[model samples]
Target chain A: MQPVLQWENVSFAYDGRFEINALSYVIEQGDFTLFFGPNGAGKTTLFKLAVGLLKPAIGRVVLGERPLSEWKTLEIAKYVAYLEQEAQYIFPFTVEEIVLMGRFPHTASQFWDRKEDLEVVAWAMEITGILRFAKRSIFQLSSGERRKVEIARALCQKPKILLLDEPTNFLDVRQQVELFETLERLNREERITIGVISHQLSLAKNFVKSAIFIQGGSVGSAGPPEAMLTPEKMSEFFGLNVSKVSVL
Target chain B: MNIMNASNSNVIARSPEGTTKQSQIQRLLRPQLGSRLAMTTGISPGKLVLIIVFFVAILFVTFLVSLLSGAAHVEWGTSEGQFILMQLRLPRTLLAFLVGMALSLAGAVFQALLRNPLADPHLLGVSAGGALGVVVGSGFLIAGSFVLAIPVLSLLGSLAAVMVVYRFSLRKGALSLYTLLLIGVVMNSLFISVIVLVQSLVRSDELTTVLFWLLGNLSFASYPRLFAISVIIFTAAWFLLRQARKLNILSFGESTAHSLGVPIERTKKIIFLVASLLTGIAVSMSGMIGFVGLIVPHLARLLFGSDYRKLLPTSAVLGGIVLILSDSLARVIVIPQELPVGVVTAFLGAPFFIYLLKRQEAKRVI
Candidate 1:
């Protein structure tokens, strides 16, 4: 099968002064890819490009052999679910209600959340272990719980690929482990492609099969996690001393 | 078996924490009776029916009172009474209903679109625009032709104000709610100043008419004027109701709504245009009736929750009822002489609005 997503020499910028240089990457079907970077490394920008929220200034971002721009937003939504760094729920939507929004791209307008939609929502909630809080207002949930609810929402889309930005942020240690384990289970059992952006190298090391390191709006290194997450690359990309601390 | 026992004891030891967890779970799972009843068969339907019934009842009583209790003491069963009822009181009551619905609906839409709790029909400069139009139409152009100038000038003024505010608020194909509101405040002040300046220049004879217009008297609204306002308000309400879903999504913020495939630019333009039209027509007919628009939507939301599907329609109906009653009260409170409908709405709506605000604050605190 063709790669699920491909970025060929993609470049972007918020303004003319600061720009993301041309960078090429590909995420294949069932691949668990982690993108790690220092602050201002364009990781979020890359995710935005993949989801077609932002257009590439140079070259192209292709999903399923179609240019990102060419794909209808609703159609692209069916194939890829993107979780932004900050997910804001401004209204008082229940967890189930929010999860049901993921199915909006597929469901008919009058049939907002029919039986099949509810089944999918329930299953997604089950997998994410947020079924207990399904009826609770999203605003009432803690940040970590809300994150799981969001993940459940994305999972409800049943997308071929999941793009998550800082999924582990604000999570407790046990919650972090649970989240990573859930992602691993989804990737292995469902064979879902996953692309994640994170600053925590050790956490990324455990979860991702392939890794990419971004620095100064450019790719510093890209390959298997073991090879890309070296001391030299870490020190160079992050501008920090790299010394491994033993975890007992 | 021993390991199971050990863990079971551990679980038992943590019983209090587990109970608290369970209690929280129970609290979340338990359907809120108030909201459920409110959603299913609560205040909305009840209020709607009551409002309708009360409006009709009050309208009938007010019509009778307006005819019989006036200086002439017209008998209800006589031809003079019937003529006064059909010609004068009926038109005024209908005008009051239309004006109230228009103002409240405009206020609701503005508050939702701007995401500001304080937005009202007059606060956004549309009322000021209508006032300015009335002043210019009566004072300069028509020279005391209040009937001819009322609709035309009000519409022109409201449309002008809306366009100015919209243009000022737009930045990169997006409108900032805060900016729009600030611009509205500034434009309202400016428009009011211009109205005042015109009032200062006009002869004393025209000043009384201007004051009456400013204070929002429905005494001059004839059958023809009521028909015109009815047509405009109904048309505007239909357009707004059709866009209710888009408005619901808009409450989620612009970027999020866009991601969900809502054509943000198109939706915003339609809402702004329709809301302004509604406000303009209402203000032109009734002058600046203050609190009905600002308070009615919030009350609807509080009673029915923030689902615009229910909120918008409920607000329109309730608004009509509120205004009709207020208008009736305005006519009856002091016999012979009458109070402006605006005065009645403000006196009633402001206290209810403050009560709602306090209730919402208390809910938040809890």
Candidate 2:
């Protein structure tokens, strides 16, 4: 199968400081991948490039066999969804309405949601376990619930590739595992490609099938969990000790 | 476990109705009436009728009170009273109502687009821009006949101001709230200073006229000119209400809107221009009336909820009510010497604004 996304010698800079330098990676179709890095290690920058929110300074970022710049913004949105970390909203939109906004790219009119849009929204909310809170104010929900709502919103867009930045930030241990399990279910059943930016190094090995370890604006390694997350490699990338805990 | 296994097919495959569990719409059980109404559709037909009836009843009473209680005393039965009602008070009240509607609707939309309840024409420097245009281009209206020239120049000025402020405030195509407000304050002062300098340069005979223009009032609008201003204000307001969904989408956050395929930069520019045009119309018609936008929009949100489709028109009506009441208060407060309507609005609006800011600050501290 063709790679769903590729970055070929991509380099990006902000205020003369390079964020992503000469980075190359190929994410195959149906891959549940972790984009693991320390803070400011260009994980978010790469995600922005993949979603066409930002353009690279040097090389091309490719999505589905075409250059990122070739697609219209709405067209790219239809194919890829990017959820920012801590998606804060101003208005008191109810859960259903917030989820329905994800279908904005699919409809002809910006205002009206069609039947299919409503159905998709219902399903998205249902899957995310927020169908019960459809009428409740999003502001009233806890951070973990709000994060779930955000995930439901991204799901309603019907994206082929869902790129989330800091998906596990506010989630507790159980919620974090549940989130990954949910995404894993979606990845297995729907074939939606997942590229999540996460700093939770220990959890990525248990939940994700593969990970891309990035350090100093370059991909240090890319492979399955056991191969890429060895203790020495973990120490090298994160400067931390890792020991296996054996269960009796 | 059951939900996890059953939903595993992943084509969004389960039929909404056939499923044993209730769909979201059916499961909605919010306690508040407005929220419950908001849950079903943007505006329920029954509630819309209720809103219309309430607004019409209140509007009729306010209109009657405004027409009958002006300083020029004539019995309601007399021809003299009829003349005042038809000629003087009627037009003034209508202009007040129209200006109020324009400013409030603009405020409502601006608040939505900027995602800040504090967004207003006066605070955003739009009114100062319009005032600048009037001060510098004094005879643009040609011997004070209430033509379209003033509104046109004012619109141009307001749009320019918004553009300048927007460009300065933009950080990566989004307006940060602090930066935008700070620049707006600086630009307002800058533009007002220019207006003062222009007033000094003008012939001494025109100084009172400039002063009257600076201190907003509603007494000068003729019926014919009121008709023209009405068309412009309503047409612009209608155009804005038509984009209600876009405003709703925008209020969430620019990135969310963008991720949902909204062209962020273009939407921002269009909304900014329309909102500025409304401010210019309000300014040109009746100098810089403060707080109609600030007060009326929050009132509308209280009644109509946050959905812009319902909120915009409701704000327009409530805005009219507030301004008509304020203008009437300006007329009858001291019994003879009429207050500048803008002064009354500021007096009413500033306290409420400070209160809102205080509440916002308290919330942050909490």
**Candidate 1 deviates by what RMSD?**
7.0
Model 2 residue runs over 4 Å out of place are: A108-110, A113-115, A241-248, B1-50, B76-78, B137-160, B166-182, B195-209, B351-366
lDDT tens digits, residue span A1-248, model 2: 66989999999999999999999999888988998877888898898888776789999988898998898878888888888888766766778777877877776264444455666776677667776677777767877788888889889789998888888898899888878887887788778898898877677778678999887789988889888777777766676655653111
How many backbone clashes can be found in candidate 2?
Answer: 0
Clashing pairs in 1: none
Best by DockQ: 2
Interface RMSD of each: 7.5, 6.5
Candidate 2 is graded, for docking, as acceptable
lDDT of 1 by residue, B1-366 (tens): 444443443333334423566546433432331122123221234555765675567556654544444444667779987887778777876787788788888888887687666778788798898888877767565444656667688889888899899999988777767788899999999999998898778766556776776787777778777777788789888878767656765666665455554556777778977888888888777778889998888877766556565677778877876787777778778877788888888888888888877875665511
Model 1, residue B219: displacement in angstroms? Answer: 3.6
Q: Model 2: per-residue lDDT, tens digit, B28-105?
A: 411222232234644445666788899999999999889877788877779987888888988888998899999998
Which residue pairs in candidate 2 have backbone atoms (N, alpha carbon, C) closer than 3 angstroms, thus clashing? none
lDDT by residue for model 1 (A1-248), tens: 45999989988878683456888888899899888877778888888888776778788999988888888766777788887776765445567666766665675244222455665765676567676666666667877898888788788778899888998888888887778888888899888899988766777788889998887677778899888887776666666666753211
Q: How good is model 2 by TM-score?
A: 0.85
Model 2 scores what on Cα lDDT? 0.77
